[model samples]
Target: MGDGALSGWERSSTARVIAPARPRKLAKVPFVELADGRLQGVVSSGSDIGRVYVSSVTAGEFAYACSTNNNRPCGGARGSYCNHIAAMVKEAVLQYGAERVARYLKCDLADAEPDAASLTRAMLATRPPAGDSKAAATVFSRFLRHLAYLEFDPATAPLPEMQWFPPTRAVA
Candidate 1:
């Protein structure tokens, strides 16, 4: 009906968000994002309301880890994923859905119906050859960096710091 030009902030490519079947409650997992070749985010501690865990599952590597922001290894992440890890997976699925998460992680899944639990089960417990602390800290640092964005007051014009960011990133 008009000139074939992309709308503002709209991409002409296949890249777009895959919304969850049901909206997720972000309170439990305040942050969940897919980046840096993993599914990572901050999950509120179950035992201590004041604490938060930085968790991530490396894509393809299938390596995972969970710990406090201060680098305290999660007591529950022994030979298996902790509840915080599970919760992060669930939130990732909620935000991006199961199929997308599986494909991103390159998970070799069974015939089971796709869900966070199934996706979690598919990941092996092989720890990354590198130290988990370094990886977790990187993820945690990113989380804090993003959190800092929320402190910015509303602006009329684009922020100079973010001008280099394209309107939409191509989905890999």
Candidate 2:
């Protein structure tokens, strides 16, 4: 009753103050490096799905922030670039060099992209003479372990034990 009954001047003295302006959204996206050392970003355009974009420091990386079709954030998912985009950019830079990365942006993956799965398969399929199935299996197991380290999230899915062993190491 005391302050409520006070005049306009008294009310002004006790009024709440407004805080300073701040950015409307969060920035920074998580990125993962491939075995080949390329960076990739995880950007969500809509529907919780995002696309990867290759980038360069000079060109500032390609972003879809200004599209009117979607009100979602352009450079990133919600105003800042996301990790998917970052990863793609990093990978491109590492794989093709900065100059090649720029040229790749204009082309599609089918033209000269390296197929990681196929490469991995080929590497694992190589066999040595002496009819060594055990050695072959061991080599394949190591390859799988390496793949798990690169592409898997250790917190959730741990790599399985390699079952292969050299024949010399096998029990008599």
Candidate 3:
């Protein structure tokens, strides 16, 4: 019982505790970088199957955890990285090289050298004209309204819940 491995009644005690089996491949989902040096993403067991939130911290050392069944073995008893970690790393590496992958995981930009031309372009894009506050305010308001309507629109929404929603019926 002291060892990490559980057997007999302990393994069978809970339905969430899945016994060690073949490591199923994970389908990659879009990942977001958190402010606190972590990456969060949702993965599915298969197409439209069990969705679980996966997060990883890649600071000094790399570590990942899943929101699904926690009783699953970490390396399938082989002492290697678990399926979740492996999948996440693979997805990250595919998007970014091994050397740059850490940047996304940690959201660290200290080492990145700034490009003067791009920085200038970005600053100019963000800065408004010298005057015409009323026009800018009106445009900003319209932009906010467009964004708000997007959340209620099904066709353009990416989330499944936001897609194909039916009209809400009022009850007397």
For this target, which candidate reaches the highest lDDT against the unseen true structure? 1
Q: How does model 3 fare in lDDT? A: 0.37
Cα RMSD of all models vs. native, in order, equals 6.5, 26.4, 24.0
How far is 168's C-alpha from truth in model 2 (Å)? 39
Error of 1 at 87 (Å): 0.9
Question: What's the TM-score of every candidate structure?
Answer: 0.73, 0.21, 0.35
Candidate 3 lDDT for residue 151: 83
lDDT on C-alpha atoms for all candidate structures: 0.77, 0.31, 0.37
By lDDT rank, best first, the candidates go 1, 3, 2
User: lDDT (0-100) at residue 129 of candidate 3?
Assistant: 27
lDDT of 2 by residue, 42-160 (tens): 22234443432222111222321221122222343343333433443444344434334443333223433434332222222332111211222233344346457778545755434
- lDDT, residue 93, model 3: 45
Which 10-residue window in model 2 sums to the lowest lDDT? 127-136
Candidate 1 lDDT = 0.77
